[model samples]
Target: MAAKGLILLLFFSGLVSSNVEKTIFLAPEAREIAHDAVLLGRRLPVLTPSNWSLRTKIDAEFPTEGSSQGKVSWFFLDNLTEYQRYEVRICWAATQPTAFTLKTYEPSVAWEQPDLRASIERFVPNSQQQDIRTGVAEPTSDQPRISSALVLQVSAAADYFTKNATLMSNVPLVDVDVVLDPYILNVFPRSLLPNAACIVLVAIGSFFVSRWVIALIDGLLRADAALEKKQQ
Candidate 1:
């Protein structure tokens, strides 16, 4: 269904006219994925001038209805290539009781239930979730990119049949920000020299400031000792 939606989106996007202009979320960092929904959150504080590699964001809507287990959403990190690195982040919104579990593997691998969760689910402030979610999917080794499909499912102790199901079904929207932040390997040293120089200067300044502080404290102690000896 998600694939089908993308097909329709590709064909009809920019072709249709609306009474009011709809908001289009472009993968700003990852322009290769020119079309997609940009979730509310920043991937990193640092900025990149070039498109050496950018994190991919895929917009997905978690189903309000699912098996007794709760709502589930499936997504694929399809916009990947060989010889690349990324920091993938998947973000979702749900209540405290509703625990999210992720299952992912390379498409080439056998379709078996993963023994362990690829990442852990966390519920933080929406403001922080975007950034916190950034760390959810850490870079797996410094190796190049490998494509995979990720399945996120919500589960809780309360049953959907029960009247007081305080999670998943109640709050089904999940923000999957499978963002891939690239490493310095691809970036030219010249491009980074400016920031690197600034960092070096800051470190040197801090070093001198700390030494001066230490000398000041030492002088004060020596003066106090000398005064005490003279008084004696």
Candidate 2:
């Protein structure tokens, strides 16, 4: 009886040791940009230039309903020569659990001209020009051009876990799935980008092999125990 129990324990231990699973996670960095534009019928020039950036955070839970969540923070700057106009848009996405996506839109424009007569003409010739002919003749190539910039920040997280004891613990198999989310950050130079989404499937077909290994060990231990019992 003792020998039989010993053999069974050894067999089950081997099965557990061979059934462990492995998983992976990722954390990405933020992105930034800079430039100029016109907003609401006003020309906004980047006097000191504009800047943009983004940051992201994520949390994931395994094998449960409503188990994952994420948050993204974004920032933007628009420098003006005098006064100018501008607009902004923001978007977010997730690739796991249920695949969630969101977007925010904001538009702004301003106009500010310099005080100096020469500076005013050099900076904003269109604002100084009175007649269409002088405006048309004054080297149109160097006309007060508008420049702007934007920044985008994103944060993300995920959770994943698998249980083998529930079903077909002795079988080998593989499975995979992917999710996606997309958003726009601006209207004029419309931003359209895709989020990551992919699934991988893998199965260990060593169930029968494991069972046989257990049987072999059990047979050896049983034989040794029988011999000992006989000797006693």
Candidate 3:
């Protein structure tokens, strides 16, 4: 269903939409990344930028919905060549539980290369496997902008690498997995350092000013009373 929605979006827009005019709860860094993705989406021929919005459809993880597991995954197979290196980055919204897992799948021996029609089925997450590696957590939220990341070093087998040593060595692969919170992107940290310094100064100033104002008012009232008694 998620795939279908993405396809429909591509089809309707003809891959020429100016911007995805939608809001979601994303962390500051994630929000910036998302904006960059949208900008890239507007320019790129492929669907790298709009991937996060599509994943939000699966569950509630955007600005509107605050709960549930929202997921987004992308593959870089379309542009892969026999003598090329690749890097992939994946980002998603963070959820309440805060648990994250990453799984890596390698290509099979029978997977043929050099054929233009060849399909790369190398990235399939194993659902039956109980043990999935835990990802490193990078909390980006002060309130709810927390996110996580996992770096995946993807390459062909040793035999394949030996055969194409020149091709593999020339290019490096980088993959980024980020789960973001759309709501907390703009939330400021509530710490008592430099941020609180301004507030604290303002508070002290207000406190003295208020005290002086009240004292003046009280003094005026007492003076008025004394004048009234003298007249009496």
Give the top-scoring candidate (lDDT): 1
Write model 1 residue lDDT over 1-232, tens digit each, in one string: 9999999998776454222101111122222111111111112211122322223222123324533443333333434334444333333333222333434333223123232222121221332444423233334344443232222222322222435555434543433333334434644333356789999999999999999999999999999999999999
What's the ranking of the predictions by TM-score, best on top? 1, 3, 2
Best by TM-score: 1
lDDT of 1: 0.36
Tell me which of candidates 2 and 3 scores higher on lDDT: 3
- List model 2 lDDT by residue over 57-141, tens digit each: 2222222243233322222233322222232322222222222222211112112322222221332433233111111121223
Clashes in candidate 1: how many? 5
List, residue by residue over 1-232, the lDDT tens digit for candidate 3. 9999999988877544231111122211221223222221222112122232112111112211421222322221111122222223233222211122223222121122222112122122321131122222223443332112111212221111335566445422212232221221234322224656888999999999999999999999999999999999
Please rank every candidate by lDDT, starting with the best.
1, 3, 2
C-alpha lDDT score of every prediction, in listed order: 0.36, 0.28, 0.29
**Candidate 1 weakest lDDT stretch, 10 residues:** 32-41
Off by over 4 Å in 2: 1-203, 230-232
Q: In model 1, what is the error at residue 58, expressed in angstroms?
A: 11
